[model samples]
Target: MRNFLIDSLGLAGFGAMNYGLYLKFGLADALISAGGLLLLLALAGARAAKRRNESKGAA
Candidate 1:
Protein backbone atom coordinates (compact mmCIF):
# COMPACT_ATOMS: atom_id res chain seq x y z
CA MET A 1 0.00 0.00 0.00
CA ARG A 2 2.44 2.62 1.21
CA ASN A 3 5.13 1.10 -0.94
CA PHE A 4 2.80 1.35 -3.91
CA LEU A 5 2.18 4.99 -3.22
CA ILE A 6 5.87 5.70 -3.03
CA ASP A 7 6.49 3.93 -6.31
CA SER A 8 3.62 5.75 -7.95
CA LEU A 9 4.93 9.08 -6.76
CA GLY A 10 8.34 8.28 -8.17
CA LEU A 11 6.84 7.28 -11.49
CA ALA A 12 4.65 10.32 -11.65
CA GLY A 13 7.58 12.55 -10.88
CA PHE A 14 9.57 11.07 -13.69
CA GLY A 15 6.67 11.45 -16.07
CA ALA A 16 6.26 15.10 -15.13
CA MET A 17 9.94 15.78 -15.55
CA ASN A 18 9.92 14.13 -18.93
CA TYR A 19 6.99 16.20 -19.97
CA GLY A 20 8.77 19.31 -18.84
CA LEU A 21 11.77 18.36 -20.91
CA TYR A 22 9.55 17.75 -23.88
CA LEU A 23 8.11 21.21 -23.37
CA LYS A 24 11.62 22.67 -23.54
CA PHE A 25 12.20 23.42 -19.92
CA GLY A 26 15.85 24.26 -19.20
CA LEU A 27 18.05 21.27 -18.52
CA ALA A 28 19.20 22.53 -15.13
CA ASP A 29 15.67 23.19 -13.93
CA ALA A 30 14.34 19.82 -14.97
CA LEU A 31 17.23 17.97 -13.42
CA ILE A 32 16.80 19.85 -10.14
CA SER A 33 13.13 18.98 -9.87
CA ALA A 34 13.78 15.37 -10.84
CA GLY A 35 16.63 15.12 -8.39
CA GLY A 36 14.48 16.45 -5.56
CA LEU A 37 11.73 13.97 -6.30
CA LEU A 38 14.24 11.16 -6.55
CA LEU A 39 15.60 12.03 -3.14
CA LEU A 40 12.11 12.06 -1.69
CA LEU A 41 11.32 8.71 -3.26
CA ALA A 42 14.54 7.21 -2.02
CA LEU A 43 13.92 8.35 1.55
CA ALA A 44 10.38 7.00 1.57
CA GLY A 45 11.50 3.69 0.15
CA ALA A 46 14.28 3.39 2.71
CA ARG A 47 11.89 4.11 5.54
CA ALA A 48 9.37 1.59 4.29
CA ALA A 49 12.05 -1.05 3.84
CA LYS A 50 13.32 -0.46 7.34
CA ARG A 51 9.86 -0.88 8.79
CA ARG A 52 9.29 -4.06 6.86
CA ASN A 53 12.57 -5.50 8.09
CA GLU A 54 11.72 -4.61 11.66
CA SER A 55 8.35 -6.32 11.37
CA LYS A 56 9.94 -9.44 9.95
CA GLY A 57 12.49 -9.54 12.75
CA ALA A 58 9.75 -9.19 15.36
CA ALA A 59 7.78 -12.02 13.85
Candidate 2:
Protein backbone atom coordinates (compact mmCIF):
# COMPACT_ATOMS: atom_id res chain seq x y z
CA MET A 1 0.00 0.00 0.00
CA ARG A 2 2.77 2.39 0.93
CA ASN A 3 4.59 1.51 -2.25
CA PHE A 4 1.42 2.17 -4.23
CA LEU A 5 1.08 5.57 -2.65
CA ILE A 6 4.68 6.53 -3.31
CA ASP A 7 4.98 5.05 -6.76
CA SER A 8 1.61 6.00 -8.22
CA LEU A 9 -0.03 8.89 -6.40
CA GLY A 10 3.19 10.64 -5.50
CA LEU A 11 4.53 10.39 -9.02
CA ALA A 12 1.27 11.60 -10.49
CA GLY A 13 1.18 14.54 -8.11
CA PHE A 14 4.70 15.70 -8.93
CA GLY A 15 4.04 15.13 -12.60
CA ALA A 16 0.96 17.32 -12.41
CA MET A 17 2.79 19.97 -10.46
CA ASN A 18 5.56 20.01 -13.01
CA TYR A 19 3.05 20.36 -15.82
CA GLY A 20 1.06 22.94 -13.89
CA LEU A 21 4.09 25.18 -13.48
CA TYR A 22 4.57 25.21 -17.23
CA LEU A 23 0.92 25.61 -18.13
CA LYS A 24 -0.23 28.00 -15.43
CA PHE A 25 2.65 30.37 -15.35
CA GLY A 26 2.46 33.69 -13.43
CA LEU A 27 -0.88 32.80 -11.80
CA ALA A 28 -1.10 33.02 -8.01
CA ASP A 29 -4.34 31.07 -8.04
CA ALA A 30 -2.57 28.05 -9.45
CA LEU A 31 -0.11 28.09 -6.60
CA ILE A 32 -2.98 28.28 -4.11
CA SER A 33 -4.66 25.32 -5.74
CA ALA A 34 -1.44 23.33 -5.66
CA GLY A 35 -1.00 24.15 -1.98
CA GLY A 36 -4.55 23.04 -1.29
CA LEU A 37 -3.94 19.73 -3.03
CA LEU A 38 -0.76 19.17 -1.01
CA LEU A 39 -2.59 20.02 2.21
CA LEU A 40 -5.32 17.50 1.44
CA LEU A 41 -2.74 14.82 0.70
CA ALA A 42 -0.99 15.50 4.01
CA LEU A 43 -4.27 15.18 5.88
CA ALA A 44 -5.08 11.91 4.14
CA GLY A 45 -1.64 10.45 4.84
CA ALA A 46 -1.99 11.35 8.51
CA ARG A 47 -5.38 9.67 8.67
CA ALA A 48 -4.05 6.50 7.06
CA ALA A 49 -1.09 6.35 9.44
CA LYS A 50 -3.41 6.85 12.37
CA ARG A 51 -5.62 3.98 11.28
CA ARG A 52 -2.60 1.70 10.86
CA ASN A 53 -1.47 2.45 14.40
CA GLU A 54 -4.97 2.09 15.79
CA SER A 55 -5.35 -1.37 14.23
CA LYS A 56 -1.99 -2.44 15.61
CA GLY A 57 -3.12 -1.71 19.17
CA ALA A 58 -6.35 -3.64 18.63
CA ALA A 59 -4.47 -6.64 17.38
Candidate 1 residue 11 Cα shift, in angstroms, is: 3.1
TM-score of each: 0.65, 0.65
Which candidate has the top score in lDDT?
Answer: 1
Name the top TM-score candidate: 1
* lDDT: worst 10-residue window of model 1: 17-26
TM-score of 2: 0.65
lDDT of 1 at 49: 100
Q: Candidate 1 at residue 11, lDDT?
A: 81
Candidate 1, residues 19-53, lDDT tens digits: the string is 77757977777777778877997899899999999
